[model samples]
Target: MLTFEEKLTIIESFPELTRNDISLGRVNFHFEESVKDKKVVVYRLHPNGNGFVYAGEIENSDYVTDSKGMVNIRDFTEKELRDVIQQSIASLSESETVTETWINNEGQTLKLIETSGVWNIYAGDDLDATHATYHAAADYLYQEGFRLL
Candidate 1:
């Protein structure tokens, strides 16, 4: 495991991340432009380092309010930390929702989702109903009172 100072040096290398030293010898990194507004904290030496990177608004995840779907970065190497930080910041700019959606004049909505190598459709955010192909998903949507828009 890298020492706190070593970690700090590596973290400081990223100019986009502003540093803020918190209590108990811990450090927090801030990305002001991030949609998921939260300080990325890398802890002092601990078995389960509180260090984490925000992963945006993911539901059904372990992250609580203080962490907007933060993923733990415990005992990370230089490469690992850099990669996680990059990905976390990147995630802030991306749509967290996994499905693509569209609505009709009547306000009824449809969604096309791709997961686990299969295409699926939903009335709104989602519904498990998997379709075999993109064409199949499109057909399902067409049959459900939706049109290409």
Candidate 2:
């Protein structure tokens, strides 16, 4: 396992990591506290590479993609990746909650209902309107630190 210091060093040196914005040439890391204090980190590599986010514990391995894309991490080691994931989880566990709203494109009212593992969308009089509404809702949830499965 990579130590915290080692992880910090790798993160600082890695040209792929971006702490400021989520765009090409940047990686956005977020930690979620809801899932047993789980940490989530997302990497948005340059357009040429696959964009993905690695998340989970340092002792055990777990990862998920931010989007469907590929990336080359030749400069980093497995331990470094582990450290980054660990640090990200720690950081997100202490963050504040951010709320956002989702609007229907057709002026149809939409509602967010908490389901067991996912958030459900309910549209008023228009199931088709759910497409845009859910898209906005997913975006809002992602911005607020929720991951889609």
Candidate 3:
């Protein structure tokens, strides 16, 4: 729970940032370096008085950490920081699907996927069979094409 002034100061420390880029929250943004580009950096603060740095397109995933697993924002280089952001954006752009595989007694592989926050049978696109939980979604798959597999 850093004070607003303290958080503002932290963001301002980056040569790329100005007073206008940050807002109080679990995360903040840095646009100084990317003023002429589409890329922007993000910082997620920790309760331990340090913060994690992310750049480029953002996603809901692990925070960028150093080689030694330090999440402190000051521990990363410009390239390292940008790499983390690029990796996350690439992974997210590659697929919105989260899938788990199961094998049947007959050795058939069944893949269950959740995409766009909805769960459905991946092979069938059974939109009407959507469910709120992985268990329910997989159950639907199991009942449909995987019952005897």
Candidate 4:
């Protein structure tokens, strides 16, 4: 089992994470640049060497999560710790970095952009509409008798 200090050292290795101590000697790591709902990844470590990591949207596999869907990091190695932390941070970061422009069949120009997971459609010269997802934004224009060019 990894000691508490060993776990702390491994967690501090990630530069993107900022450590904040909570009540009961527990610590929380917050990814400031994250624009998603899970910017904070939960890490609970106990003196008994029992610990857990929750990186949002857990997968099912050996040592992945309990029936409650929490990752047991009690016996996790340095590699295991690093991998989970990296994934946790990435899962909350913005998924898009560029804007794309397309034209409709009627020759109307449409600019598609995503900001903090909100998709926007700019038709012609101004921001025309907003949608929750990129696909939804595209679908809205399609329903307006717009066809991809």
* TM-score on alpha carbons, each prediction: 0.47, 0.23, 0.27, 0.54
Local accuracy of candidate 4 as per-residue lDDT tens digits, 1-149: 68888988888877777888876787767778877655556456665666677644532224456654458788888767766765565456666443776676667778776755567675542347767887898888778767655
lDDT of 3 by residue, 56-125 (tens): 2334435554653334554544444444443333333435554766556666655465643445443332
Error of 3 at 37 (Å): 17
Inter-residue clash pairs, candidate 2: 31-92, 39-89, 50-69, 50-70, 53-66
**In what order do the candidates fall by lDDT, top score first?**
4, 1, 3, 2
Off by over 4 Å in 3: 1-94, 124-129, 142-149
Q: C-alpha displacement of 108 in model 4, angstroms?
A: 44
lDDT of each: 0.58, 0.40, 0.47, 0.67
lDDT of 2: 0.40
* Candidate RMSDs in order: 11.3, 14.3, 15.4, 12.7
Candidate 3: residue 143 Cα off by (Å): 4.1
For candidate 1, list the clashing residue pairs, or say none.
Answer: none
Better of 2 and 4 by TM-score: 4
Model 4 lowest lDDT segment of ten: 55-64
Best by lDDT: 4
Across 4-104, the per-residue lDDT of candidate 2 in tens digits comes to 34544555553333454555555454433334443335555333433344533322233332343222332446554544443344333433222233454
